[model samples]
Target: MTKTWLIYALGGGWGHITRALSLGRIAAKHSKVRILTNSPYAHYLNAEGCLVQWIPDSAGFSATCQQVRHIILNAECDRLIIDTFPRGLGGELADILPQLQHIPRILIHRDINPRYIAAKNLRSFVAENFDAVIVPGEGKDLPFCDLPNVHHTAPWLIRSDVDLPERTLTRSHILKVNETIKTILVCCAGQAEELPLFAEIALKLHQEFPKCAVRILAADCPPNCQDLWISHHPGIECLAVADVVVGGAGYNTVYECAALRVPLVAIALKRLYDRQDKRAQAYCYWVQDIQSAIDTVKMLVDRIEPQKKPLPSYINGAVQAVHHIMSYKF
Candidate 1:
């Protein structure tokens, strides 16, 4: 009988869903893989050929828990992979924890902020419940670093050619573009709350360097900044060929830029869970002030070559994670 795996990617953002898809693709080769998520990115999950069960975000905690429990019990999965939140976002997994106690539970624990350091109860719950923990990519100085069951692997990236075929094609088209027209890619976070700041920077950069092309990848464009907006998902090709990339220090974007060896100017955004500020400081050319971030992008655009470099071993995190999962005794 084929092994069956149920991946619980409970969260709001694209990060959790993307990570789950990356691992799910690998696991599908050896097992029947299905994803349970509440993310709006469920369509992307379906597109990747995984069976996705969408949990309504507006559903009450108890209702959500019942839905998840029903699915898991019915599937009779051999293994369970929980992404990010150990207790499930909004504690929806609490009800199913006991039911899954007999099976192997793997937690894809990402880096956390200082606030989580005081979450003693949450940490203790994870320690007691999870069979193994996988930390993706340069997750040094994490709260769970000392945990005996925790395993560190390369940064979890969703870069499979099968997952992002459009990006692969875009990359080829971008590579053929003339080098004389300099390109700068600005990726505001998914929320795009900082659209005004990005607009101001884009205007300044356009004025300062008239020959350069400024492309902003955002959900919405601010007033009078329509020319800069490039509404597209997974703008990896634009990032790959850009003279410089200015963006928030979100995990997926930062690691993607790094893997493509694009020159980056990462502005630390305050997030509740992931310490993007710390990650930016450690990995990229980080700046606290918006003005400094713009200045850094300008400097890199002038100095650095717009050529791709081979990703380091640490950035190949998804592969490492798959190997570890497949080899685990449980």
Candidate 2:
């Protein structure tokens, strides 16, 4: 009999859906997977053999609650895996998880705002309802690590090294100067409002490194950006060729950079749940402003070589996450 796994990935931005797809892709090999989300990029991220239940951002709390509650009662959902915000982005799932106690409920417990945890009293509620709580990133920073059945894993990224698209740079660009071509890839996949900020960095970097090719990789191409490569997810192929990667210090970007051993000059953005400041400090080259980002990029470029020395690869959380999720036999 084929099992069906339901994953709640309603968090804003591309991170949750991408991470959800990573797990769903693996789960789809044996079991059917349904990922419920509200990402604008859902159309581009729909995985084969897995269903994407797209919810709109305009859908208010009551409607979202109705939809999520109905899915929980869905007889086809053999297991439920929630990606952060256990109670939904705005408490939509507060009363939903408990209603489905018979089904095995798993939580992808990435770090969140400490104040929200206290306000929601999630510690007790999660401890009682969730059968398993997996932290996709480092669990050290999270306050509620003591929760029952909590497992620590690495960051879950959309694509792995082996899965990354082969070199996308042009032959002229690659063979330019008969040596390493200066390629700067700026990834801005989170909030669309921050596109200007990321674009500013891209422009400044272009101005600073006029001869080098500075490409902007975002959901939508920024205005006046000379070279723009648009994509719904992080630019994995571009990251492989980037001399210096620039982006916000979100979970996916930071770890993906580290995994590929590509140098990153990440600007830490303040988030309600994710502590990007801390992540920026720990994993990559941290910078405060556009100017600092440019300076760091320059420093990184100066030391960068055409051929990178092999370094140990970071653990891929999707593999480990699938292992844990699949272990709960139907």
Candidate 3:
């Protein structure tokens, strides 16, 4: 019988969805591949042909346990790929691992620290149940305690061809704010609460450099801030037009910047469950505070020229990951 591969994406973000889609694109060609996540993401993944499972919202451990049991017992999965289990603020799954010990499992992690103090306490209690932990980078900044279980894997897997407008179009209609002030681009996932501060920074930078124009890009911007906000698709289009890009140090954003060779100003925003500091500092020239709109705009004016080094990509990353998963014997 053909093996059934089920990927549970617990983390909430476009990055997790992107990973699931990329893996499904690669693995579906050879075996049965399924993706599970919450709605909207599930709908999108289902539309893409992967067998989709939507994890229902559960207020507490009892609700989560019911959902997990239902899926694991019902699905005829031979292998399970989980992206950041204990790290995604859903630690209840850790307690129920013994119940699903019959299946081989793999955990995908892209953070700089696997044992980040916040996620460490939870992961420490649950990691033994996993068969492998795949780390995409060289493990430069991650904590050293979990070295034995970590697999230094390839770069992240991304959609094979993101539809980008012709590169020449970017240079043709270039809009310059002023003769001296350079252009800068800013973008982030929807939860960015520091946008107001960033806008303030942008105003300051514009005052400092009379010729600069800073473009703020995001999915959902407060109505009052529409003047600078470039919504979704248009915002992504701006990436090709930008001289430098500033935003949070998210896995997808960082990878996209590297792939496009744009200089980055990665922000360090603190949340109850997430922080991008370690991921930002690992890359050269990636600064945290430069995400302030004014500071970012000034930084762009100072360094409009592209960095000398080429960027990274995951064109082969999917293939490599599949090979690893396939090589494992149950």
Judged by lDDT, which candidate is best? 2
lDDT of 2 by residue, 1-330 (tens): 788999999877888888888788878988989999888777766475689988886787788778777776765777899888878886777776788878898988887778888998988888888888888876566866876588887788666656654453321343122225677788897787898998888888888987677778886778777455545344565566666789998877888888888888888887888788888888989988888889888887787665334333556788889898878653
CA shift of 258, model 1, Å: 2.0
Better of 2 and 3 by TM-score: 2
**lDDT per model vs. reference:** 0.72, 0.77, 0.58
Q: Which candidate order results from sorting by lDDT in descending order?
A: 2, 1, 3
Q: Can you tell me which runs of candidate 3 are displaced by over 4 Å?
A: 1-3, 39-52, 55-65, 86-88, 112-127, 138-149, 160-165, 168-183, 190-214, 233-241, 272-274, 284-293, 305-316
lDDT of 2: 0.77
Instruction: Please say which candidate is ahead in TM-score: 1 or 3.
Output: 1
Note the residue pairs that clash in candidate 2. Answer: none
- Please give the lDDT score at residue 330 for candidate 2: 35
In model 2, the runs with Cα more than 4 Å from the true position are 46-48, 168-179, 232-234, 307-314
- Residue-wise C-alpha lDDT for candidate 3, range 51-161, written one tens digit per residue: 766675433557665675567656788888877554334554655555667888777765544435454564555466777667654354554337466666545544432
Whole-model lDDT, candidate 1?
0.72
Error of 3 at 36 (Å): 2.3
